[model samples]
Target: MRFTFKCYATKHPEQTVIFTLLLSIFLLAYQLRIYEVPYFRMIGLKDFEQFESAVWLVVITMGTVGFGDIVPVTIFGRMITMVASLWGAFIFTLVLISFGSRFNLSTKQKQAMHQLVSQHKAARLIISAYRLYKLKRSKEGMGSNKSVLSESDKGISSLMRRLKEMAKDFKDERPKRRRVKNSKSQLI
Candidate 1:
C-alpha cells in the first residue's frame, strides 16, 4: 500500500498534494478515535477529555517520537502507529530530495563556473606580473643608460606575457552579451 501510494504520488504531483492533505485529516480523526475509545489502550494521557491532547498525541506519533508517555496496547493501534511513523518518514524524504534537486547545478553550468574561476585567476596573475615588471623598471632609475636585462627580470617579463596570452584565450571562449535599452534610453 505504501509503495502504491509513492508510485501514484510520483506520477501525479497535483493529486499527491490533495491526497496528502486528506490523509492528514484522516489520521488526525483516527488518532482522536484511538484516544476516545477505552479499548484502544494508550498510556501517558492524564485525560482524554480534550481534543487538543489527541491532536498532540497524533503529532507526536507522526514524528516517530515514542516518548514512552503514550503507547498503543492493541494490535490494531500498533499497526496504525507504525503506519503513521513510516508515512512521516516518507514525506520528509520526498521533501528533502525535491529541495536538493532544486539547488543542484547542471553539468553545463558547472563547466561554465570552472571556466570563470580559471579566467579570474589568470587575470589576477597578469596584473601581479605587470606590477612586478613596473616596480623593477622603476628601481633601475630613469638616468641609467644600461639596456641589459637580468635573468630574474627576463623571467618576470616572460611570465607577464604568457599570462596576457592566457587571459586573451579565456576571453575568446566566453559568451557574448546583447545590449538592451530601457524606455528612457530608447527615448534619448
Candidate 2:
C-alpha cells in the first residue's frame, strides 16, 4: 500500500502533499520504533524500519538540528546517515539559490519602477512652472506703455513651444494608462 501510494504521489502533485505528510508521520513512528527496538534481537533492520529511520534522519539533518540522542550504530545505518546528510545539504543550497534569485529580481524591478515615476513627476513640475511664468509675463506686458502686444506674443509663443516639447517627452515615457468604464459607457 505504501509503495502504491508513493507511485501515485509521483504522478499527481495534488496528492503528493498529502502523501508526503502521511509518509513523514510514518517515518517518525518508525524512528521511535528503531530507537526502542533491541539491536541484538535483529540480524538486519528490515526495509520499512530502515526507510523510516533514513527519512527521519534526513529531515533532522536538513533542519540543522541533530538531537544526538538517536545515533546510528550499525554499518548500514551509518551509511544511510551519510547519504541523508548529503541530500540535506543539496536541498538547502537549492532553497538559498531560489530565494536569492527572487530577491535580486524584485529589487531590480522596484528601482526601474521608481525611476519611471520620478521622470513623470519632473515633467509635471516643469509644465506647472512654465504656466506660472507665462501668467506673470502676460501681466507685465499688459501694464507697460510701449508695444506690449508684440512682447506678450513672443513670450507666450516660446512658453507654448517649450510646454509642447515637455509634453511629448512625458508622453513617451509615461506608464500605459488603464481605462475603466462605467455602466453608463463613460470612461474613468
- Please report the candidate that would top TM-score against the real structure: 1
- Candidate 2's displacement at residue 51, Å, is 8.0
- Candidate 2 lDDT by residue in tens digits, 85-108: 665565556455544554553434
Worst 10 residues of 2 by lDDT: 176-185
TM-score of 1: 0.48
* Model 2, residue pairs in steric clash: none
Error of 1 at 99 (Å): 2.5
Error of 1 at 28 (Å): 6.5
Clashing pairs in 1: none
- Please report the candidate that would top lDDT against the real structure: 1
TM-score, each model?
0.48, 0.35
Give Cα distance to truth, residue 93, candidate 1, Å. 0.7
Q: Write model 1 residue lDDT over 8-84, tens digit each, in one string.
A: 87777556755674567366646655645565335444444455655565567766776766555567667766777
The global Cα lDDT (0 to 1) of model 2 is: 0.56
